[model samples]
Target: MSLRKIKRPQGDFWFDFEAFAEDEDGFWLRGPVGTPWRAPHATGSSEVPVVVLLAPGRPWAAWWVGDPADRRLEIDVCRPPERDGNGWQYVDLELDPVLHETEGRVEIEDWDEYDESVRNGWMTADDAKLARVVAEGCAQLLHQRSEPWLDRGWKMLPDS
Candidate 1:
């Protein structure tokens, strides 16, 4: 199946992945290295295996990248994903909490873009507030390494 991410004021990104597993929380998707992905401006294949967790009612999606040098974990603050056909789709809230394992730190990224979206009315005030809350909470979880999905996703990674 494919996961589609709709970015406010801009593009749509989609990637095909195996529906590897599912539980009470939500679905788990696995994309092997070389899996193709497309965005409005560009297209490419993943350089490493990836696992993503999309939990319904949670305002974020968690991703685990297999490469150690890369940002190992990234949480995209967004609206809860909705099932679409055989896939899922959500509108990105723009803020993201990324864990760079090599650096041993978590960074909140894309704040500028998020601010722009809010200012331009690409997102409503309530949506912007929700995004901020989710982003901050996710960042704290990333910093403390306390999110269960993070560990679950790590373990699910191939050869983790």
Candidate 2:
């Protein structure tokens, strides 16, 4: 089987088409492409689903959801509660639980020291059940593909 390739701003991250969020309702809105903050995070609650990309400790973007029936899922993108100036600050992402339940919180320290690079201190809480389902689906897509690494410039070696 041939590996299917999709073009993303940051070069091309390998992902199965079927598993990737391709629906028009789904989109990735974050910092510039190739940036660490460049992942499609949360979905919206409005008639149109919005895909948000949050900064490490700053609230940079928001994707609006226009429809309640729309399914919004946020991936791993949360920081730690941190100090801003006079008090501590944290990032909170909330969605309509009845229609979509994708809530994420990130702790932060001082606004200046706030950075996504520090991984240990931060925690990303996603729907365990939903994560499992998405993981399984991705695995199945990989199984169906043949040369999944072709896009990565991998070739068969001969001799020895």
Candidate 3:
């Protein structure tokens, strides 16, 4: 997988995206093609990953080396991703679990929204736990400078 530095309100960091593809063994394979991420097996065997964003120590947030061991984020929701007018999608209102990095720790940008989701039955307890696991896992994976942070298994829709 390839990574590029991006500047956004969430924070500045290296980012990349991946698509899932069934491998020869039928298990899903992810990542670009070549290099460390060129080939990575899916951990959960999920056929299609929702959407994700990850960043390293925080060059976007200011180069703060983070502890990959830390996992204390309260995942609030994992609603359907909001898509833009052009069809590009991103986490946004009604379906967003904000992530942030501070002093080497991954933090949730909003617990209120997450709580509200639970209060309104917008997100279930089980789904909340799944979201938490995904966020925490991302926190750990993004701590390193390796290509793992930019992984995307090369599962993109063809431009026909």
> What is the lDDT, from 0 to 100, of the residue 14 in candidate 3?
25
Per-residue alpha-carbon lDDT of candidate 2 for residues 128-148, written as tens digits (9 for 90 to 100): 233234334433433343433
Per-residue lDDT for 1-160 in model 3, tens only? 2232211223222223343433322212123222131112222222222222332221111111122433122222233333233222223222222233334344445556556756776666775665565555545554552543233221231111
Q: How much is 100 displaced in model 3, in angstroms? A: 6.7
What's every prediction's RMSD, in angstroms? 1.6, 19.3, 14.6
Ranking by TM-score: 1, 3, 2
* Stretches of candidate 2 exceeding 4 Å from the true structure: 1-126, 146-160
Provide the clash count, candidate 1: 0
Summarize candidate 1's per-residue lDDT along 1-160 as a digit string, tens digits. 9999999767899999889899876899999888899998999998888899997888899888888567478888999988889798999999999998778788899999998999999999999999999999989888888657667787888652
Distance (Å) between predicted and true CA of 143, model 1? Answer: 1.9
Of the candidates shown, which would achieve the greatest TM-score relative to the real structure? 1
Q: Is candidate 1 or candidate 2 better by lDDT?
A: 1
- For model 2, what is the error of residue 159's alpha carbon versus the real structure, in angstroms, after optimal superposition? 24
Q: Give the clashing pairs for model 3.
A: 12-60, 18-152, 19-155, 30-153, 31-152, 31-153, 58-63
Candidate 3 TM-score to native: 0.33
